[model samples]
Target: MRRLLEGVVPGELLLHYLSLLARGRLSVEEAPGLLDGAGNIDALIREGMAYCHGDDHSMLVAASPDLVLQRALARMAGHLAAEHQRLLDGQERLRAIQAPTDATAGGAMDQLVQILTDGGKIAELTLTLAGSAQRDWLILGARMAADASDATSTSANCRALYESRCVASAGERESVEAVIRAGGMVRLAPRVGMSMRLADEAIALLPLSERNPSGALLIQSSVIVGALREYFELLWERATPYGVPDVEEGPLPPIQMKILRLLVQGLSDTVVAERVGVSVTTVGRHVTAIREALGVQHRFALGVVAVQQGLVE
Candidate 1:
C-alpha cells in the first residue's frame, strides 16, 4: 500500500473511491474512518497530492472533507454550465435563422388562414366536453370549427377545406347516437363565441383558452374528424329525438337489412335494384315496407333506425 502511494495513486483509484462514496459505501460518520489506519492516511495524502496534474490542481489543494466535496461539486457545476450555455447558444441561432421567414399578415382569421395556407404546422389537442347533447352540438360544431382549425394548420392542404365539412346528416347523427348509447363519450359547450365556416358546416365557439367552447385545432388529414363523423352517425341513430318521445326498438327483417345496408352505403333505389337483381319498383316497395316496419317518417330516418337496430350487421 505504501509502495502504491509512493509514485502517485492513479486517477482510476481516486475515481473508484469517488464512485464508492457516490454509491453510499462511505456514510457521513464513516468518512473519518477513511482518514484512520497507518498506511491509509499516507495513501490518501499521496492521492490528494497526485490530483495536481492537468485540471485536478484545485482538488489537490482542497483540504478537509467539506472542501473535497465542494471541489467535486464545482467540477459538476462547470460541466452543467457548459452544457446549458451550448443549448442557449443553439436556441438563439435557430431563432435568428427562423425569425425573418415568419411574416404573418391580415386580421385574426385572415392571418390565420394565410399562415395555414402559407405553411403553418397543425397542433393536436385532446378536449373534454360537457354533456351528451352538447356532445351532439360539438359534433355539429366541428363542421363550423373546420375553417378556424384549418387556418391554424401549417401548409394546410387545399383539400382540407373540402374535407373540413362537418357532414352530420340525419344518417350521421344516428351513428353518433349509436356510439353514445354504446358508452362512448360525446359532449359540447352550449355557449360558443367565435364563428367558423368550412363549406356547408359552420361552428361558433368561445376561444378554447378562455372558456369551454366548440372550437379546437382540427387536422383534416387526420382521421379524428372522420371518426367523429362516424361516431356522430352512431349517436344520431340511437339518440331519442330532442322534442319527440323515445321510440321503441322495432324488429327489422333480413331483407330490410340488405336494403338498409345498400342505402347507407349511398346507393340509389335504381342502383340498389340492379345490385339486388330486382326492379326499381320492387326496391321501392321494399323501402316503403322497411320504413313502415321502422315507423320512421322518411327514408333517411329508416336508414338511421335500421343502423341503430343492427339491421345492417
Candidate 2:
C-alpha cells in the first residue's frame, strides 16, 4: 500500500489488488486509500476500472451500452403509447363539438329553414320580423311555418304545432299580413324597435350598421337559446293578435304606385309629374287613386300605409 502510489509499488502487490477488485473483494472507492497516490501499476489498475470495467463508469456514471439501449426502447414505447392516447382523445373531442353544431345548423335563414323543414324534435316556433323584411324571406317563413303542421302528411312530425306566431315591428305590416294570410298568428308591435330576427332554436343578432337584416350572429348555445325562447314566450303571452280592419278598397294603379314613391321622397305633385312625364293634375289623380287603393283617406295616411307595407326603401 505504501509503495503503490509512491511510484514503486511491486507488480505482485498490484496484481493482488487487481485480483481483489475483480473478485469484488475491493471497491474502487475503497482502493483509493490503499495506495500512496503514485505508481504505474496502480494507475493502470485505476484506468482499467474507470474505462474498461462496466461496474465503475458504466454502472455508476451511467447505464451500460446494452442497458442504455433497452431503456431507450422502453421509453420509446411509453412515448408512443401516450401520443396515441392523446391523439384519440383529441379526435373524440373534435367529433363531439362538430356533431351537434354542423349537422343541425348554419346561418340564420338556413337554420330557420332547416328547423321548419324538419318540423320534428320541435314544437312551436316564434318568429320576429323587421320593418324591411324581405318579401321572399317573409313568404318562406310563413309558408314553412304553415306546412310544419299541415295535417296532410300524418307523419306525426310535430307533436303540437301551434299556430305560427309572429311579432312584427312597425312598417312590417305587409310582411306580417303575408304571414297572417298563411294562417299565422300575427301581432303588430307598433312601438317595438326592430332588432335582429328571433326564433326558438336560433336568434339573429345583426350589426345595426349593416343594412341587411340577415347580417347577424346566429346564436345556438342551448343556454342562450333557451333564455330567448322563454323571453319570446313572455312577449307572446302579452301580445294581442290583430287582424286587418275592413274598409272600402280601390285598385293600386301603376301610376298611383309611382306617385306614392315620389310623394315619399319629399317630392311635390309637380315634381312627381315631371319625373313620371305626366301633368300635375294627372299626378294628383294618381295620388287620389293611391289613397283610395290603400284604404287610407288622405295623403299622410297614404305615406303611413306605404311605410307599413314596405313600399319604399
Candidate 3:
C-alpha cells in the first residue's frame, strides 16, 4: 500500500507512518518516538489520517485506512482538475498564436502582436504598464485585481469590469474590495468572456484565453488597442457598479460575528480558529451556525449571503 501511494501521500516518512497506523503496529504513545528529525507526525494529522487529543499530554490517534485513502484520492482529483484546466488553456493559447495575424493600415503585420510565453515576463510587463499609466487603466477579468491595485496607486484612474459569477468566492470578493478601497472603480457584468488590460489607450494586454496566466498577446498597434478600448466602454456602460446589498439582517453573537468577518476575508478554518482563540471544531460549529443564520449552503455562498444580508462588512 505504501509503494502504491508513493506520489499520493507526498512524503515517504508520512506514508510509513500512515501504513504503521493502519496496520495497528504503532500505538498512540509509541507514535511520538517515531518522530525523528526527518519525520513529521503532524503531516498525518493534517491529512486526516491521524488526530491529537488531551490538553496537557497530546496523544495521536490514527483514522481508519478507508477514510485516509478517500481523502488522499479526493486531493489528487482536485490537482488533476486544475491541471486539466491548465492544459485546455495552453491549447487555446497555442491556437491563437498559430492563427494568421491581422494586417494594419500599412498592410503590414509587424509588431502588431507580441506573444508572451513566460509567466514572469507577463507579470513584469503588466506591472510596468500599470505603473507607467498616467491617464487611465481599463481591465476586464477576475485575476487582474493586482494590476488594478497597482494602477490605482499610480496617477492613472483605474476602472475594472468583472463577471459577477467569477467574483463570488471570498478570496475574489476580498481582492475586488481591496481594489475599490484603493480608489479604483469596479463594475459587475453578467459575463466577461476574456481577460484583458488597456493602459492609457496606447497598449493592450490580452490573455490567449480565460485563466491562461502564462500566455498573452501584448498589442501596441493603435487600431487594435482602440477597438478594445471601445469594447470595454460599451460593456462598462451596461455594467452595474460594485455595491453591497441594502438589506439588513438581525445581529449575530459577538464571537460568530468575528468569525463571520474572518471568513469573509477568506481565512481558512485553522487560521480562524487560532485568531479566535478557539478550537477548529468550535470554529466549524460556529461556521455551521452562521450558515444556518444566513440561509446559505456552501462556504462561498455563505460569504456572499453574509455580505448581502449586511451581516459582515
- Per-candidate TM equals 0.26, 0.26, 0.43
Candidate 2 residue pairs in clash (backbone atoms < 3 Å):
5-38
lDDT of 2 by residue, 1-313 (tens): 2232223333544454444445443344544444333353355444332222454532212113344334445666888999999999998897577656543233233233232333321112322322212221111122232222221122111111123334344534444543333323334333323332343243433222224322234454667655655645555555444553433322343455567888998888788888988656446544654564477887877777888877666
* lDDT (10s digit) by residue, model 1, range 127-151: 1111111212232333332223322
* Candidate number with greatest TM-score: 3
Comparison by TM-score, 2 against 3, better one:
3
Q: Is candidate 1 or candidate 2 better by TM-score?
A: 1
**Top candidate (lDDT):** 3
Per-residue alpha-carbon lDDT of model 3 for 1-313, expressed as tens digits? 5655557677865555665576554455667567542246667767787666556434666767667778999999999999999999998786466455432111222467787666665666677777778778777885642343553444466778889985778887877766554446678999977889888988898877666565778898899999999999999899987743333525555667788899889899999889988667557656765665567788789777877877767
User: Candidate 1 vs candidate 3: which has greater lDDT?
Assistant: 3
Q: Predictions ranked by TM-score, top down? A: 3, 1, 2
After superposing candidate 3, which stretches have Cα over 4 Å from the reference?
1-110, 144-153, 244-313
How close to the true structure is residue 29 of candidate 2, measured as C-alpha lDDT? 59
lDDT of each: 0.40, 0.43, 0.70
